[model samples]
Target: MKVFVFLTLLACGAFAQQGPQCKAPNGGGLQPVLEEFVALIPTDKVLELVLTAMTSDPETQAVMEFLSSSEFYQVVDLVQSQPAFKSLLEFACSDLYLDAAYYFNILAGIFGFPEVHNQTRAAARTAGFRGLLLDILELIPVDELKALLDQKLKSDYYLQVAFQKINSDEFGSIIEALQGDAAYNNMKNRLRGLGVDVDLIIDTISKIFKP
Candidate 1:
């Protein structure tokens, strides 16, 4: 798994070296890079690798178990009970979501992926994804979901254990391997070219696992 991640990073560094071709499109930028990345490594294979790694790690298994616990359901219930959240769900079911979907379809067409555009349009019309979300919102019992948020915030055992695993030397070694000196420099330079604040992003992500 570590080897695969390291190779993937190296491939991305090579892609970063392709000067003009790596540039973002007229209205957007990341899509072209993403397309190139996807071309090199299929999305399904990436997802498979991620799932394999997660399932093989005991700490990740604990985190996944916690996510499916009753307490997590309480968290979901609390969020779903919020008027603001409900409003957002309603908005998603509105024409605005369709507009965004159409916009993405246009982008797919522009990027020379007619199959992607056609599939998206077909799914937008036939798939009941939006309808299912609306139904879930309507079915949630808001009164029952009115539990205090503090009750859920009190437990940090599983999260703390997960963070410990993330901050461990084993995990750090994996990160170091994936971010080898050359690959790290190349990524930073590429992100800078795209006007990203690499230091700020690194700082923000680093804080998440801080003790």
Candidate 2:
């Protein structure tokens, strides 16, 4: 009986040294449990709440402090060194995130897609084309925008369409009108008024129309 008790104690000590297993048959780790809890939340409301918090002084300050911390830099370095982190970084920097609110608003409109006078569209249109263009340009990085345009312009279909349009009678008439002495002079005057060098404008347009 004494020998049996000693062996049992030794086995228990070995088990403790090996570490006790976390045996939750239903839930696994803290991450999985937190993810499950978050899944229950209305994400739209949560997003709006988070945005509101970030805009507040306290929350922004807290975020700035954490971002400037050595701990945050260590985490960033670790994440960047991981191979899988590139994919996540790409996703985070993608158009999906840049236009997340736009996509969500579109999704919201789908419920009432058949209905007229969508407030969202109306509000956007009311902001005016130039204002909207500026807002969109502000959101996109200059290099990414340039690369996207270059790729699109390089496509066979896009080049074909552009060639066809430029060869059309309407395009011919537009070029003729723009190239006329009176029209060209008026254009130069207008450009000069807008602080552009008339000589520079003429030189640029001349190169564009040159064979």
**Which residues of candidate 2, in runs, are more than 4 Å off?**
1-144, 154-159, 167-170, 181-184, 198-211
Q: lDDT per prediction?
A: 0.33, 0.32
- Model 2 TM-score, all chains together: 0.23
User: How many clashes show up in model 1?
Assistant: 1
TM-score of each: 0.28, 0.23
- Supply the TM-score for candidate 1: 0.28
Name every residue pair that clashes in candidate 2.
Answer: none
Q: Indicate the residue-level lDDT of 4 in model 2.
A: 21
lDDT of 2 by residue, 1-211 (tens): 2212111111111101122222123223221222233354354543444344445435333543554465544444443344332332222123112111222223223322111111111112212222322332233343443343345445434333433444556444434443443533443354344333334333322332222
Over 1-211, each residue of candidate 1 has an lDDT whose tens digit, in order, gives: 3322322222212111122221212322222322333354334544443355345544434544544465544443443344433332232223112111222233223322221111110111112223222232333332222221122223433323333444556545645543544534554464454333444434432332123
Leading candidate by TM-score: 1
